[model samples]
Target chain A: MATLSLRDVRKSFAATQVLHGIELEVADGELVVIVGASGCGKSTLLRIVAGLETATSGQVVINNRDVTELEPADRDIAMVFQNYALYPHMSVFGNMAYGLKIRGMDKAEIERRVKAAAEILGIGPLLERKPKQLSGGQRQRVAMGRAIVREPALFLFDEPLSNLDAKLRVQMRAEIRRLQRRLGVTSLFVTHDQVEAMTLGDRLVVMNAGRAAQVAPPMEIFERPADTYVAGFIGSPAMNFIPAVLEDGGASAKLEDGSSIRFADGPRPGPAGRRLTLGLRPEHVEPTNGDGSIPLTVELIEPLGSETVVHGRAAGGMPIVTRLQGAFSGQSLSVHLSPKHLHVFDAETGRRLDS
Target chain B: MSSTALPAAVPMQAERDDALLRATRRRRVMSKIVAHGALILGVLIVAFPIWMTLVGSTHDAATIGRGDVPLLPGSHAIENYATAWNEGGGKSRTTPAALMLWNSLLMALLIAVGKITISILSAYAVVFFRFPLRMAAFWAIFITLMLPVEVRIIPTFQVIVDLSLGNTWAGLIIPLIASATATLLFRQFFLTIPDEFVEAAKIDGAGPLRFLKDVVLPLSLTNIAAMFVILFIYGWNQYLWPLLIINDRSMETIVVGLSKMIGSGDSQNEWNTIMATAVLALLPPVLVVALMQRWFVRGLTETEK
Candidate 1:
């Protein structure tokens, strides 16, 4: 019954509408991640779901019951914020038990639950410490512990790992995913980092500006982007876009410097003769001394040890990045783009074209 | 800026570099010294009057007037203090000055608590919630910051009179309950409170009042304590309003009553006792402020951050 659904959710601050109509659902024990850049209204959407903000015109149902107008306190949910937002004056124990104490929980019960949560978060030794005394990671753990003690129906995380350093963020991200899985709680995590959303979410929701670009499993989102924006945003190095024209029953991409690239797969009707946007993931394209390969002169080679990222441009100034395997160090390497991984988009609307 | 711009700008303006560098450096150093000197001078100007009150408290009236009286402690401080306390009030019945002291303390406490309660809650309402006329009410209250309390004194006085609080503690406390400055200060500090914190509390399922008490109140200790100190000092040191309102010497606050004693020194006022009572009059605020200074500056600075 703790499953939630948002129907036609919208928000506007005066003249500016920050969130368009957003429809989403979360079944019991599901983990959903909403990913978008800053000011894209991803955080606002999460805030609305958490009952911290009211949607301008929408129905938010929790457990199939309309909880749209309910006070946040009565909504039966818990949230962890990006900044942790720990009560500075309170010790860790006090912070964890504050909500229960307000709900008239028995003193011993509050203590026991707080202690248990502290143990779960590995903050038992630091319960007496204030937030100021703890490190960033510890503070994050305390924030989680405070949420855990509430034992609410759903958990809301608003970029909770964003404040941590890279190493800590990675480690905490895994820990949070593991914890969420173990607790089997319905959770909605909001983050601008697509990598985080892809890895941590049971279902990844890619948001662009204010709308959901695509919603799918990680592999599906990465492999089959719903649109040009989703293709560009979901991947780390981003999909390269090359302007193309369909000719002789095939697609041909024209580079700015007048060089042309031909894909082995023939072009379809709607996208032929018109300007076509060609998409290639960095990993799918490669350096080759073979035929049907796009020639590229490497301008820079970023050797990331495991996978080298080759940055180069075609004769037409269409910049491209090729993800290569091990030790390819040079500034003039040529890449062979695989037609199998190529994505076609209609140039007019940036929508992905089906093969 | 790009690295090329520096060399381009530097060489093309060769004539501008003539005395510009030296003059600017010299001006920087001169202004630095003057700034520090002014700061020290300003502190001295503020502290000297309080210091004088303390020194005057330790001596008889004639010694105080000697002008060359040493800054060090005098021998008769204890006796002078006792005399100031004993004769500072009235002719026997309940030693009305004690009653005055009690009355002033009660009024100040009531006013301080009332002003703080109304102001902090109002600020919270404006900051973290949304309703019709929210911004309108905020702007209306904010416009008061531009209008000095001095400008509204006549109307405020009339309002106090109409409420039948004339010459009473209620008269003193009521007009001071909703201070524009306190609300403004509280609003500033409250704005620094992150909305994320409120959301976190909300998702924890906390009601508005509970959120305020359990979350907002705890986070706001330093600010509230600092604001409390400031408002208390204002209430304690109030003079002109009390003088105009309270004709009863027995009900007069220390400032008003002290003014009366100084002005009506018809029997060669006991300078020793006057100085001592003056010292007593200043102690509470001075001690409270000194103790709370750390929190005050911290709160003020955080308001901007």
Candidate 2:
């Protein structure tokens, strides 16, 4: 396993700068996922690390060696592409053995490695079949097997499960995580799916507009995102933002409708009377009929078996969504906002405020 | 009570269904008859000339000379074939049909293979790699499609003579090998290969040449077979180029020999032998097409990548 580091990696295509000074480090045996919307430079960063694209200005160090100028093959890295990219004419065995063969490995060793990888992927029976004959999930497994056979210092995955159906994606996500843990190879996974990033990564680099908005563990990012962009991006159904003003000497946030939420954690890092943005996650809002609850005029209800998501507007016509554990149907509901889960950002800058 | 009521209503619906089925079956049979009739008529119309040639090959020359070409075969088939195979018709340029067939086979095989090799490599370089003036080079090659061999016959003939390649297989084949149509077809096919395959191969430690051998060539098998069939026919039927290049009677192609076998005024030509030689000329190309027809149709329609 190797430790991978990117130092001030910047990329440009003609006049457009796709990656603007990205810095990251993956400890040996760690999985770091780069996640963003399409065209947000996440894939560009992964390609730069894979040596498919040269950084405009930077250094890529892997296992204490600077590999910025090396070809992808010489860099000891293997990549699993989104489409699987299998040679259609070759059997599964051939696809996995191609790299080892090119490296001049003997037939016995190549066969051994391919057989072992196929077994691990539960695709031993499929090794004799062509890629076109396999189901989507099987092809995904073969793609993983091909990468695993290389036994490279690092593994690069570019949305490897994006083409599969939803249930299969979840299954493969766990399989990939388990496989990476067992192999203990440093890996960099890039995807546009936040849930995949959250579930699979040891740590995530949440990218926005060609820059890393936040880099932290998934739960840490979910609980305390560094900025408004990360706050809205990392969680499903997204975090809600409401215009507010800091009152009571930064101890509480007074929203535009005159309702206020007190910070139970402590005094936040903002001046009194300063305009701020208040953030709350959908799952953190509890439906309550008690005092100190915000009234929500319910507009829509989505029943998702175990959880019910309610969409509505609060006072001052600010849209809000609340995900509750049980089902509820009504014209209005009072929801209690936990002060511990409240996020505050400066109105102009959108940077998170710490208590 | 509901079951009894349902059984009574079912008989009426069954009557209607039976009527509809009979009408549909009648229409289907009528269409099938019309289709078979048209196909049989088409086969007869197309096969008439071949039938005439086959029948004439079995008759004596005197029968054909009197302009009473027989509708039935005579007992002269064996004699006519033997004469044509051993000593071709009307004697001015009697390269035996056997030697002519061998010469035609060699030329067609060489030309087809040579053109495919040149075209695939040129197309690969054009589509896969970026170089200075790449599009300019592509457009230049594309412009050659306008200049058929017939248009540049005199200059090409001069070049062949200057090189002193007359009557040689090199002279016969090389001038006809570089085809713009084949090159363009290959270039179009190569462009559709996904970029990811190239990147994956590069990561697998395969250089450009290795990738072409291991991946590109196998993927192009169908296309190559299809091109082989077409180019073989084109090369086999070539009349003007072979006529201009080969002065030696020993190297004359079957097409050229067949035409020369028809003698000028007042010379009696062996019509049966000429007809037999014509049959031999048509066999190799028909076999090539029949053998490769499946891949030819597939390659034209679908790209594996």
Candidate 3:
């Protein structure tokens, strides 16, 4: 196990800068997932840490050793690729033992490690089968076994489960978590799947446009996102943003329909009349018929077995989606945006504002 | 009531379906007959010459010289083959058919193996390495495809002579070994290998040479087998170049030797021994193609990667 520190990491290609000074610290035995949308450079960051790609400027320290100039082989890391990257001609045992053989390890030791890893992965009977003969999930297990046998200082996973079907993806994701926990290896996982990140990582690094928008535990990122991007990205149906202005000495926000809702928390530290964007998650919006509730003209309704999702527009044509616990058949309803779950952000900058 | 009604309606529909199925089966059988007929006709068309050569090889020289080539094997088969294998057939009878066959076999084996080795390495370098003028080097090799041996025969002959390789095995094999077609084929195959394999190999601590030996070579076995068959045939059938270069009777190849066995006056030629030698020359290439037939088809049609 080892700590990884990417200090002031920056990358540029030709004239376009892809990564603009990313700084991160991954503690030993911590599975830090770098999650983002496609083209956000999450894979690039993982490749840099794997020593597959060199950082244009900065230092990559693994276990307190600067290894920026080292080759991927000398860096002592293992990577599980998205496509499994198993040698098609070799058997499962050969695939797992390749790295050990390359390092000049004894034949008996290689066999022992491969056998142990195969046993742990529950693929003992498939040791002699080529990759083409195995199913997709079995191939994924072999890929993981290849990495496990190396016992490297760090493990790099580049969306290893992305090629599997949805059910297998979920199953393998948990297996990977359990295996990593048992091995106690420091790992950096990169993916464009927020759900995978949320369910698999000890801590999540939400990347936006090559920058770490927020770095925290999954629930913390869901509960208190650092910016509007993270807030909208993490939650299902996404958090809704209603354009408003700070009013009543920053104690309340006045919507465009001339309706005002006081903050349940303390007043935000902003001047009166300041433009603010109020964030409300779909699950947090309650359907109410009481006073001060905004009227919603329902446009669509999706009935998912245990819950219903209502899509509608509020006054001033602001689109809003709310998740209700039970089925509701209505052409129109009123939704109360709770102050306790509101996310306050500055309109000028998408940064979150604290009360 | 519904079950009783269903049986009554089912007979009419079932009869119609049965008629349709019979018609479909009739058409399929008719098509199979036509296909088999065409295939048999094609086989006869292609196999007639080889059959004629085989039948003629079993007859005495007097029967062939009189233009009465036998349709059936005669009792002289053993004698004709023994004469062809032991004694040379020509004006002076200096070079034995066995020696010519041995020379041709060596040349074909050398050329096929040398071409495959050089082309695979060149293709690997062109596809995997980032060197200066890599594309330029590839295009240079590709450009040679247009220049067949006949096109540059004079200059190539002069170079071989200048290098003092004339009438030598090197002169016969080296000029023909640098194959542009095989190199291009291998380059295309290598391009389909995903980048992830390279990255995984790197992470596994395999250097470039190790990666080539462990991964690239094993993956390329089918292509190599396929190329060996084609290159072997190409080398075996070489007539004009071998004739133009080798003046020594000892270095004469089977193709050139077989052609020389025929005289301008038909009566002076030993047609039985010549036919037996002709049959001998066709054996090695046929054996190679037969042995590697599976890999040859798979290499051309399917990609294991």
- Where model 2 places Cα greater than 4 Å from the true spot, the runs are A269-273, B1-30, B294-305
Task: Give per-residue CA lDDT, model 2, range B1-305, as digits (tens).
Answer: 99889988999999999999999999999999999999999999999889899999999899998899788888899988888888887756399999999999999999999999999999999998989999998999899999988999999999999999989999999999998899999999888788889988988989989999999889888889989999999999999999989989999999999999998867878888999999988999999998799766777565555
Off by over 4 Å in 1: A248-274, B1-83, B89-97, B142-151, B262-267, B290-305
Q: What DockQ results do all the predictions give, each relative to the true complex?
A: 0.35, 0.67, 0.71
Docking class of 1: acceptable
Q: Scored by CA lDDT, what does every candidate get?
A: 0.80, 0.92, 0.91
Name the 10 consecutive residues with the lowest summed lDDT in model 3 chain B: B295-304
Please name the candidate that would achieve the greatest DockQ relative to the true structure: 3
Compose the digit string of candidate 3's lDDT tens values, residues A184-287: 99999998888999999999999999799999999999999999999988888888899999996889999999989888888987778999989999998899
Q: Model 1 over residues A5-37: C-alpha lDDT tens digits?
A: 999999999989887888888889999999888
lDDT of 3 by residue, B138-237 (tens): 9999999998889999999999999999899889899999999999999998998889999999999999999999999888888889889999999999
User: Candidate 2 versus the native: TM-score?
Assistant: 0.93
Worst 10-residue lDDT window, candidate 1 chain A: A248-257
On the 0 to 100 scale, the lDDT of residue B89 in model 3 is 69
> What local lDDT score does residue B298 receive in model 2, on the 0 to 100 scale?
75
